[model samples]
Target: RVRSASYGGTQMRYRLQAGATELHAAAPAMHAHAPGNEVTLALPPERLWILPVEQ
Candidate 1:
């Protein structure tokens, strides 16, 4: 869960990978993301929930 701060406005890029499979995602941070505002990151079901080991 991404808890955005008050008066937040920025672009966020996220990348997730497992083994040979990888996923890239981007979201537009809204300026109105203030107070109780939050952004939730949902992962794909096809990918297994494993630890990402960097080589």
Candidate 2:
């Protein structure tokens, strides 16, 4: 999952979770990160994509 705050605002921190995994994550402008199968985060106008992981 992904979430975002405006580029010009009180910058805050966020905690991301998936099952038992937790990530201390933040988006500075257009941050894009993909860490696993079917997960993507594009932020600062938060966008998310879950693409299939081909095996």
Candidate 3:
């Protein structure tokens, strides 16, 4: 469920929940992020980064 969102000029902040987890994501403002609205997340390979965890 989507909690809330704040729209900026070219980006927006979104708060969402999935079970016991809550996520705050930032992305381009190409769509409306109204409160209580459901949203889909897509991360392409070009936008993905892999980092090694320190032991």
Score each candidate by Cα lDDT: 0.46, 0.46, 0.79
Count the clashes in each prediction. Answer: 0, 0, 0
Best by lDDT: 3
What ranges in model 1 sit over 4 Å off? 1-9, 18-20, 30-55
Deviation in Å, model 3, residue 26 alpha carbon: 1.1
Per-model TM values vs. the true structure:
0.27, 0.30, 0.64
Q: Candidate 1 has which clashing residue pairs, if any?
A: none
Clashing pairs in 3: none
Deviation in angstroms for 6 in model 3? 0.1
Ranking by TM-score: 3, 2, 1
Give me the displacement of residue 10 in model 2, in angstroms.
5.4
Q: Tens digit of lDDT per residue, candidate 1, span 1-55?
A: 3233322246554443444654444556542333333344466778546567889
Residue 41's lDDT within candidate 1 is 49
Off by over 4 Å in 2: 1-10, 29-55
lDDT per residue, candidate 3, 3-34, as tens digits?
A: 88899789988898867977777778987678
Q: For model 2, where is the 10-residue window of minimal lDDT?
A: 2-11
TM-score for candidate 2, please give it: 0.30
